[model samples]
Target: MIEIFGIPLSAFLSQLLLGLVNGSFYAMLSLGLAVIFGMLNIINFAHGALYMMGAFLAWMGLEYLGLNYWAMLLLAPLAVGVLGILIERLMLRWLYKLDHLYGLLLTFGITLVAEGVFRSFYGVSGQRYAVPDLLTGATDLGFMVLPNYRAWVVVASITVCLAVWALIEKTTLGATLRAGTENPRLVQAFGINVPRMVTLTYAGGVALAAFAGVLAAPILQVQPLMGSNLIIVVFAVVVIGGMGSILGSILTGLGLGVIEGLTKVFYPEASNTVVFLIMDIVLLIRPAGLFGKER
Candidate 1:
């Protein structure tokens, strides 16, 4: 019976939860983007396609191999990560020394080709993925009923984000990665095999995307165009957080998700465009992005 601004508390909390779910996806995807761009300087327009591929891979494993959600959760990302490695070695590597536009174009083309291939067989209709048996029910929070799967998603996403942040910021390997990207030639001189490191970095980023896709599969339908539908907003999130900033991406993504959710509650008409509007405002004020270094 309680209300805030004439909106039921339950409705507001529900929207907030939905927003956090979305923000979890945004954080994961943009984290991948940040890693790839920061460590490899690749625009990776195909990231969304890879995400879709992950979801499809999970669905296929379930249908054909009788794999469960837990199994596919591991397998799908590994599969996509291997594919990402192939992509880097076979195609993306060649464009590294070239302009950033080249990498963007190549990845964009890959996105188109991937979408086309999937669409040819699957068509445009979405496929459903059921929630894992263990996470099938809802939990009664004192104020709101929370879906167990959604709670898992938020917890898992935040945990992953923190782990990745620590990996990049606190560890010796992370230091080497940052140095390798900044000066590959110098790192190569030290017998680090910088190229291999770069390849792995890209693979790791791709795996993160796949992981997100797997997480999203049960919530959203598995479809070819799913990636395209969300990629732009993820990109906006990355940009607003500051390109290549891990912490920025995580925080900004969660914050924006909550803001967007609240907008739906207060001003339904602007819900869809609210993120973009914020992006515009951020760009006007800080062109380097909220967390990016001015270079």
Candidate 2:
């Protein structure tokens, strides 16, 4: 058996693949965060809670409504996005002119409320979600055996990330969004509905988080507190990549995942801290983040 640094090649490859899976989730969640921060200038503290809600939505649909994964994929995001729209209109909009901290606090409160409610009913234990029948096996690669579901997650996340990037960077609508964020008053004077755009943008960002949650449901059991731990790591990713940079979020997420995976292989004790260490180094070198333009 071939070995590098006294570790079997297969084990190394397996860890790498697992890391990629984690990175995929980071990319999706961070991308949504970037979008929300770019448009609203608010760091949404409730994002993780909403993500938890999405997974629960999938679980509820399956258990109570007999909905399949494919259907829940569309429905969960739509439901959560609608909820986001309402939150913006009723609660968040009032705080736009206030300090950014107000928005953060409000969302944080919402997260607590949501998590508390879910935990009361579901208890601390996690609920299971079966992998879709279509993606229910593993394939043998030359160096490693790859689980089909994990591979699908990597592929699906990449597709979603690329599509979002293209939407924000290439299309005319994206141009308008960019312009609106830079100067909403001027854009409003030009007859565009800036307020409406802001509402839609928040909803869209929340939808991205929900979509990621749906993707994660089968892999990680549906649980109220699941998003709690993951969100902290994702925030580190956002800080390292810069808060509002779409492309930066994607690349940094994937890259950090692979680095974390490799760390697990070569230095097991450092696997958890490696990303934060990178974040610290990046902050020292470029406070605006690796891709952020200095303001």
**Quick one: best lDDT, which candidate?**
1
When summed lDDT is taken over every stretch of 10 residues in candidate 1, the lowest stretch is 252-261
For model 1 the TM-score comes to 0.99
Across residues 1-295, which tens digit of lDDT does each residue of candidate 1 receive?
9999999999999999999999999999999999999999999999999999999999999999999999999999999999999999999999988999999999999999999999999999999999999999999988899999999999999999999999999999999999999999999998899989999999999999999999999999999999999999999999999999999999988988889889999999999999999999999999989999999
- Shift of residue 259 alpha carbon in model 2, Å: 1.3
The residue ranges of model 2 lying beyond 4 angstroms of the native Cα positions read none
Which digits, one per residue and each the tens of the lDDT, describe model 2 over residues 1-295?
A: 9998899999988998999999999999999999999888988988899889889999999999999999999999999999999999999999988998899899999999989999999998999999999999999988999999999999999999999999999999999999999999899999999999999999999998898899999999899998887888988999999989999999989989999999999999999999999999999999989998899
What's the lDDT of the predicted structure labeled candidate 1?
0.95
Q: What is the lDDT of residue 133 in candidate 1?
A: 94
lDDT of each: 0.95, 0.92
> How well does candidate 2 score on lDDT at residue 7?
91
